[model samples]
Target: MGAGLARFARNRMALFGAAILLGLLLLVLATPALFPGDPFRLVGPALQPPGGRFLLGTDTLGRDVAAQIAYGARTSLLIGVGATLGAILFGVIVGGLAGYYRGAVEIVLMRVTEFFQTIPAFVLAILIVAILSPSVTSEIIAIAAVSWPGIARLVRGEFAALGGREFILACTGLGASDARIIFRHMLPNCTAPIIAVGSLLIGTAILIEAGLAFLGLGDPNVMSWGLIISAGRAVLRSAWWICTFPGIAILLTVLAINLVGDGLNEALNPRLRER
Candidate 1:
């Protein structure tokens, strides 16, 4: 494990990406304590431009944009982590079962995954959310529901490739139960792509949440980067701070996740090995 980490450290871009991600995570976790004023507080004059006191300026609601940005981090982090975990958990179980068992189970699982994959992710998420409540939990369920298909395909491919490997075959020949072979022998070997995909999905999940919020389907009470942008869009010409700061936050957070995901993909892919 130490040796693997040492190799990972040699990838300067990966290390930098990890640092940026960590910083954002820390910022989100500490937002409540670090920022003083209430995000909804109307202490400042409405539509104020960036200046002293209210650093990022004030919205039409007379609330501090800076405070909203800080709180927004927490919202984005929650959605990203929640959706990613949901995708990973659902993907691993379904993919593992299909790959390990094969035959009818594989066909059914693959077909279901393909059916979901055929639809546009945003449209599907919106449709699902539209049917049920359009709250944070609904948003999470929608994203995760669509998100897992890709993860399932990735895991399925990996599992199929690894199932026929010597170690897995030996485990099977030893009369190991399907669960034991699938979980212990095959799954551990598939971690690289899974980790890479999970990292990449975190960014996708964040973007999806932002998109949902931008479309006015997200929780009205939540202070997400997307919600800030959506609220600011109406007054963008007069008060650029309303959109600008939130846009920057979304951009930076997404960029950080992408960088980390890219680094992980490069690090984990043997086909991309350096000369």
Candidate 2:
């Protein structure tokens, strides 16, 4: 872990990305104190430019844009982490089973995973969220539903490759239980790529969540960056601050995630480290 951290610190772009994510986490934690009032409340004249009483100006409803942005960080973090974990968890399980026990099991599981991969991810997320209630929970589940297929395939490939290795063969020769060989042995070996891929998935999940919110499928009860953008589409020409700030936030967050993912791949991948 210490060596990995040293390697990660050496990558300037990844360091910058890590800094961005750290700042975002701090913002999410400080949101309630920094903007205590309800973000949705009308605070002043609508379409106010960025400055004066409100740092980021006001939305059409006179809600403080800064407040919305701060609060929206919470939504993004929540949904991003939540959705990624759900997807990775299910994916590891399904993929583990398929790869660890090939033949009929692999065929069946891989076929199901391929079925999901054939669908356009965003369209599938939209359909799922539209069918279910449009809320934070729904958003997480929707994003996870679309995300798991890729994860499953990745894990399956990792397991298949590792299965032929001497350590796995030796473990099997000792009559180790399937559960032990998988969870205690195989899963640990495959975590480097899994972590790299999972980091990227969080960024993807956030983008999907934002897209859903932009289309008005977001929870009416909460204020997300996308919801703010949606509210500003009508007055986009005049009060650009409303959408602009949040758009930048989403863009920066996703970019940071991607950079961090690259860093993790480099630090965690032994082949990369050797090179």
Off by over 4 Å in 1: none
Using Cα atoms with residue i matched to residue i, what is each candidate's TM-score against the true structure? Answer: 0.95, 0.98
lDDT measured at residue 132 in model 1 versus the true structure, 0 to 100: 79
TM-score between model 2 and native: 0.98
Ten consecutive residues with minimal summed lDDT in candidate 1? 1-10
- Per-residue lDDT of 77-119 in model 1, one digit per residue for the tens? 8888898999999999888878877899999999999998999
> How many clashing residue pairs appear in each of the predictions shown?
0, 0
How far off is residue 229 in model 2, in Å? 0.5
lDDT of 2 by residue, 113-187 (tens): 999999999999999999997999999999999999888998999999999999999999999999999989999
Candidate RMSDs in order: 1.6, 0.8
- Please list the C-alpha lDDT of all candidates, in the order they appear: 0.85, 0.93
